[model samples]
Target: MNLLSFWIAHRADMLGAIAQHLTLTLVATIAAIAIAVPLGIVATRRPRLGTALLTFANIAQTVPSLAMFGFLVALPLLGGVGARSALLVLILYALLPIMRNTVAGIQGIDRAARDAGVALGMTPQQLLLQVELPLAMPTMVAGVRVAAVVGVGAATIAAAIGAGGLGDYIFRGLSMTEPTLILAGAVPAALLALAVDASLGWLERAMTPGAARSRRVTTRAMTVGGVVLLLIVMGGYAVSGRWGSRVIVGSKNFSEQVILGELLAQVIERTTDLSVERRLNLGGTFISDQALQSGAIDAYVEYTGTALTAIFHQPVLRDHVDVLERVTAAYAATGRAVLSPLGFNNTFAILIRAADAQRLNLTTISDAAPHTPGWKAAFGYEFLEREDGYKGLVRTYGLRFAGTPHVMDLTLSYRALAGGSVDLIAGEATSGLIKGLDLYMLEDDRRYFPPYHAIPVVRTETLAAHPELRTAIERLAGRISEEAMRQMNYDVDVSRRDVTVVAREFLDTVLQSP
Candidate 1:
């Protein structure tokens, strides 16, 4: 199905997502305007301060929004992750354009006009409010326009940190390899940007004094209409209680994660009286973990390897049972429970194109480590940057490569490796799409990578409220063997099957049989 059709099919979700996307953008834009305009005004008055403020704004823009979101997630003062961190990041992003524009707009005003105001006995404040600001409205609006558009686009990435938006569909679609799902998100987002830009443009034009009075009135009417429309959207969401659900399941951006998340939601809905709210297809492992901690998500599936390496910064292991026990014990101390592991390991391994592996005689991580200098290494965003990820592993192994390790989106990492563009990929899982690309998973003889047994991680509060949810989910835990996970992964990643279908089938087979 095309994206429009997918959105139509999932209209309820699409609407909820739209509401969330707009909320983040609007809040961030208003905050940005409030702060940026004053900062811009001050900067205009003091040229030295303006340069420093502009430099700071530029620097803030340099930090990728995703990285900024991650940084916030790690901050203790930020108190874990969720919408607040996401909002802070979005505001940071919006500031640069808004601030710069405000300064430019205020400064861009005609010098003669300012002189006229002064000659007419207007005070500095009066000159600014009546002459400068009025003349600068169009420029300021343009800046806000840029910030709003950028904010909307950046807000999509907020899904990575459990900040709901259209990004949920895009990330989920990427995980499931379904273009339709992505379209469901992308199209609406594009429409939203256009709508916002046009709305703001009209407002700016209306605010321009001496413009046709009729045009001004029309612009005012349009602005009022936009506000009313937003209110209606919010009212609808409130009535639906999208924010008040008792259970919210979230997942990292990957097919297996999505499937496991759906399985958890489905099982909970079937076996428990609590309502199920799926917030699946969130971003990286850290983001999802923070989401659970911050009360954005009640529970979600995670791998033991991630909990050990990414969360705990421990060594990866070969022994699955021992690893699970250690991780469970550790997590339990944090008021989180690692439920019974589903007997399978989806640990990270190096993947190279079949041809490249043969050429290099690389059968293991150690073998490939020395030769990494010979080929460019491409990694998924999280895997490349995390301390427990490629940086740590490469340092620990004492391996040097000639080429700089490059980071790509996780969804594209396999394709890049398979196409021979990247010689080595650091964090390949058994269910990764690279399996079908004639690539081989290098052996981790020293076992630097941890066993990634799939399991559900839940806050202690959630467990206390829904004790049976764990057992119900555990029913399908070990049912998926390593080979089964590989095949199921292929079905979604390679064969292009719907994740929901695959998850439902797995659940039916495991729960309905015997």
Candidate 2:
């Protein structure tokens, strides 16, 4: 009932997600059909070309979906952040099935039927249109069915890049740790895929040779379906910005990031006339950075040390003010203005199960280092790969476990340790899940990690366009203390409260204060 009530209350968002999802699937599948059918036909005539085509399709089909999205985000004119890039990735995935089926369908035609057409004084084009296409129609439609269903599932990931779909709710749900939101997005998408499969399957059956009279009817319906989908894509593409009001804001995919993203949006809403368009739960720091740099979003919160080292590739600085100064300057050089710190330092912490800490009398990294050979450990992908992350920490502490550090999502790592799936993890200092789940943070005795004060990174152009933003952001300066942020993260991650409500309540209290 909680999920149902929430769904009903936010039916507008749910409906919009469905529309965006349908549009992405329809557009990609239709565009795939337009390209694939011709290529499939030509490949049937050219033996060598057919081999090369299949090889290329197979290679493209094998590239991971997230990697493909990242690849496209770097391409010029044709790609960036949004539906265009997502459409291209979806079309690439849709191609192999559609093309392979088209070639198979055409080549699978009976030789006797072709001979009859030739004997009946039919031209090559006439034979192809009358005999070949009709016979191949059913199989080709099967390909379309597969591609459409695949596109629907893949479209959910598109939300990671700011392309609105059922995925937006799914990612948001994961960040908030709310199963209700997940179902709100996922259940609709699954049903949509089944609906597409059934509808296309019916059409494929209707195109059989015995149903000649209904052939044109089904084909016309197919064309109409494509046109309807294209219209939906255009009509709603600009509207329904998933709680957006313009001035797009984005954030990395995690509880803290989502709350901060909403914090910025709500602050903008309260201080300025321009409505904020949020694109939160992005894949990670890189995706959020790419979106901001590409102008897909106007602003997002970034960590000072992360910007200094991870993004700028500069060496780490231990002093908090020094790291902030260097990060702000580096961002300014790249046309991004880094604002005042939000008054929280979320440096990485080596965490252990509280039980283990108590049993082993572990109070610091050095104390836990001796027993590491018996314990399993894990870290987030960013941590494992970063200059300030796992590699450096291990070298600094010489802490060796029984095996190598397992890579896991930052948020999930907390629960994994608590649940005894792993004995150790690198977690954020301010993560609410730490206290909520009874996990213990070992002291960073080596001080290997740098200060990671949170600050808003906004485009210089966006600031100039909306001068009011400077003051609005300044309102947040030195505002969110470490304790306040931890409690808010706990409210969402542990208490399971809505992020928007938490951000709004915080803002209400902040504005009412002297």
- Model 1: what TM-score? 0.83
For candidate 1, the lDDT comes to: 0.79
Best lDDT among the predictions, by candidate number? 2
TM-score of each: 0.83, 0.93
lDDT of 2 at 137: 87
Residue 372 lDDT in candidate 1:
64
lDDT (0 to 1) per candidate: 0.79, 0.88
Stretches of candidate 1 off by over 4 Å are: 44-51, 104-132, 174-178, 235-241, 315-317, 349-411, 422-429, 432-435, 440-450
Relative to the true structure, candidate 2 has a C-alpha RMSD (angstroms) of: 2.6
**lDDT tens digits, residues 1-514, model 2?**
9878887877756666778899899889999999999889989999799889888988999999988888888788887888899999999999999999999999999999999999999999999999998899899999999999999999999998888789998988876668988988989899999989988987998987798767777778879887876665555544455444478889899999999999998898898888777788877888888889989899999998888888999997899888888888888998999888888899888899888899989999999988998889988988888899878888899889988878877888888898888899999899898899998999988788999999999999999988999889879888899899999999999998888899999999887786
Task: In angstroms, give how far residue 93 of model 1 lies from its true place.
Answer: 2.6
